[model samples]
Every structure is written in C-alpha cells, then in structure tokens.
Target: MAINPDAVGTTGTPVESSWTSKDSLLYAVGIGAGTTDLAFTTENSMNIAQRAYPTQAVVLGDASGAFANIGTFNPAMLVHGEQAITLHRELPVQGSVVTTGEVTAVWDKGKGAVVEVTSRSVAPDGEPMFDKVMSVFIRGEGGFGGERGPSGSRSMPHEGSTPDLEVTLTTREDQALTYRLSGDRNPLHSDPSFAALAGFDRPILHGLCTYGFTGRALLQGLCEGDPARFRSMEGRFSSPVFPGESLTVRMWRDGAGAARFSTHGGDGRVVLDAGRVTFDPA
Candidate 1:
C-alpha cells in the first residue's frame, strides 16, 4: 500500500490557535533569553531580543479533535522530528492573535511515517504575522500498506547504554504565564476550564517551550553558550509538564559533536523522551 500525499494533507481537520506577547518573551526565557547577570533582572527582560537574526516562534497546537485514527496508532510512538518558524514582525508585549494550522504534507520512509503541519499566525488586524512548519515522525508506523516516499530520517545513536548527564530545573508556579508572554496563548495553557475540556487536568506548558529550554540547557553545557556552534535540536513531548516543578534533563553525548537528550519530572517520571540534538565545534 502507498500513502497519498494529497489525502494526508487533507485528512485532518483545520484548527485555529491564538497567541500573545507574553507568550513570546516567556518562550525566549525558556530558550535562555537573559544574558549573563542581566538575564534575570527586570531591565533585561523588558527588552525584546534573540540569540541570532532569526527569531522565529513555534507552538504546540494539538488537533486531537480532527485526528484521523485516534485510537489505532499509538501517540507514544510519535516523535517531533523537524521544526521551522518565520517571524513577520516583533511580537507585542500582550494581545490576542490566531494561528490557523493545517496538515501540510506526509511522507513515508519505510521505517516510519512523517507528518508535517503548516501554521499561519495572523494578528486581529488580519495581517499575517508569521508562518511555521512542524513535523513528527512515528517510528514503526510504516508498512501499514502505505507507499514509501522521500524523507529525512535521524540516524540512531551507537549501540550501547551510556552514562548520561542530567540537569534539573524547577519552574515557578506562574511559569506558564511568564512563558506565554514570550508569544503563545493557546488558552489551553492559561485557562483551566479550557484545558480540562482539552483533556488536561490543568493548564500545561507549551511543547516548544520545553524544547527551547532543552536547547538552552544543551547550549549551556555543550556549546558553552555559543549559538553559532549549535547546528540543530529536536525532540518529542511524551507527556505534559505542569508549572511549578523540577524538570530533570538527561544528556547522552555521542561524541564531541552530536548528542541525545531527554527530561524527567522531579518525581523521576519521564516528561520528554527520544530527544536528539546536534552541535559543532566553535
């Protein structure tokens, strides 16, 4: 069986997610925004900055309601593989914005299935603010009679159990509120009733926010805080992380360059698994 790209693109229902300024700044901090002693001070945070020229934003907007086969495929088997964000303009400190998301494409690589989504963030003024594409790969979800296609695959780390480096950080009770100021406000992370309706006990942290924090920690430990030496970072969100808790991140460096990462909760429960990141010599 072969997979239909057209069918894949149109299979899922469409969705609209909103955001705000606090969302972007919070996201910046989650990705290590503060610089030096200035990082935490009020004066430093008020300034909108980026590690580099490309300051893009990514969001974790789930479309569970529009899922094709909610039960058949294991969501656990899903792993975020690729992400790209484009900034249209500087995000305001606070306001409401909507992000419309749709299934962009899907590719089959014999070993797994890759699903891609394209999102458009628009301001209330109807001006397009940015465009983003997020992707996920489901391992062992292939050969379900779907046709294989061109795709990029991650090379697994060398065989063997290696001792990993772990770092844990505790988030403030209102961490989500702070993180959201960075530029995301999907309501699911801020509104309890909305979250409960979405199937979450309470508001949850953004997946990309966690990803950015993972990158920040990696850059600190592996790259010595040099952004240019960093090549790429990717991961999957196995579970939702609540605010006001300790997040423990474990790192497995394959060599002096590439590394694999994951994070667990203070309770030692895995929050993010199957995380892979890469870096280069400065």
Candidate 2:
C-alpha cells in the first residue's frame, strides 16, 4: 500500500469526550504508578494527593480514527516511532474536552512511510490543555516517490555527573488489559493470537504505557509529584516491553528544570531513548 501524499494536511472530525477521576486513576494503575506512588493510582490516600498522569494526553485526544484518512496501511506493520507532548495546563481529574487533529506530513522511507500527526485538546471552556505530535511508521507503504519530509532536531545525550535520580516501575502481567480501557484497543496489546501473528511471544505492552511510566518517573523524580509542573516530554521508542517486565528510568538534569532520561527494560534493553522532559520551576 503506497501512501497518498495528498493525505497530508487532511483534518479529521473533531471529537468531544469526557473522563472522570476513576478514569485517571485507572490510567495511573495501568502504567504501574500504584507500585510506588499512591498519588497517581489511588483514589484517596492520607498523605498523597491524587492526580492524573501527564501522558494521559495520548488518550484524552484519541486521534486514531483520524489516521484512517491516510489511505490503507497494514495495521500489523505499523509501529509508533516517536512522540512529543506539550502541556499548557494541568489536566483535570474530570472534565469534558474537545479534540481536533490533522495529518501534518508524510515522508517516503523506501520500505515505509513516516506519517506525522498533530493533535490538540481544549477544555470545555475552550482553553488549550495539551497538544501532541506523533510519528508513526507504516511498513511496506512507501515508493510513491514523495518528499523525505522534515527531520527532527537532534537530541543531545545525557551529560554532567551521575544521574540526579532514578525510578523503577514493575508492570503487571495484565497491564496491557488495564491500559486498553483507556481507549486504545489495539490487538497487538491484547489479543494473544493477534500478537503471535505479529511475531511476538504474546501480547506486548503499549508503547504509550511505557511512555506514561517514564512520565511518572519524571514527575516523581524531578517535579515533586506535581502534574502542573510537567511542561513537555519527547522520546523515541527503541524497543518493546512485555507486560510483566520491570523498567528503570534514569534521569540527568539537563538544565534549570529539565532532564534527559532513558528507560531500560528488565532485559537491559533501552525501551525509550532520546528522551527529554521539561517542567515549570514555579
């Protein structure tokens, strides 16, 4: 399936959705937040304040339907390559939101097409809450002879002395099942048979789930467990993580209130790379 270059700039129908406190708590649990922090996973705790994980923006917008406009591409051959998210305001535990998105660019990569998508969500009051730019690679969907597209800025490796902090999260065996409740019902993360056909021993965890865990680590390690301070996060998916694996995220302070970090799976493979997180000092 060759990608249609014309699909670029195509906008999708806007979606209106709402979520509650329970929804936020469940998303926190799905990413293993409850293991070490009560603030994110538990509904109520004596010492910790309940809050929504920042990475939940990926679900709050839910722009998967918009991608269908880009022409036919094998679902099994698609993979998330990169993701960048910016938070304009702290996410509420319960609120109605309006999300709209558009295809930004499509580049031919010989064996595939790299599609870039940009989506934004606004609160019921029409104030921007968060925005995300995602890169998805569609395998065997290239060769239509299109432009190579824009190049991402180079991410600098971690510098300075030892890591300022580290956090480890252990995923549950059914982590993906719980994560799916957040709205992404991709078979690759749930259906064992579908996963097997996709060349996995069993269903794999959602890359975004790991992304959420990394975000949680950033919040805990540097942001004082405050969601309001989380400003932006960007990272590349380097490898897949199983549901039951433990991931360790090591962070190095990059600037005033920013850090460069990476998450390593239980097998010692870097699951996330070229990661950067920024937070408001105030």
Among these predictions, the greatest lDDT belongs to 2
The digit string of per-residue lDDT tens for model 2 on 181-232 reads 9888999999999999889999999999999989988888888888999999
- Alpha-carbon RMSD, each predicted model: 7.9, 2.2
Q: Mark the regions of model 1 whose C-alpha exceeds 4 Å error after superposition.
A: 1-4, 7-26, 30-104, 107-114, 118-133, 136-164
Runs in model 2 lying further than 4 Å from the true structure: 46-49, 150-156, 159-162
lDDT of each: 0.60, 0.86
Can you give the lDDT of residue 20 in candidate 2? 91
lDDT of 2 at 225: 84
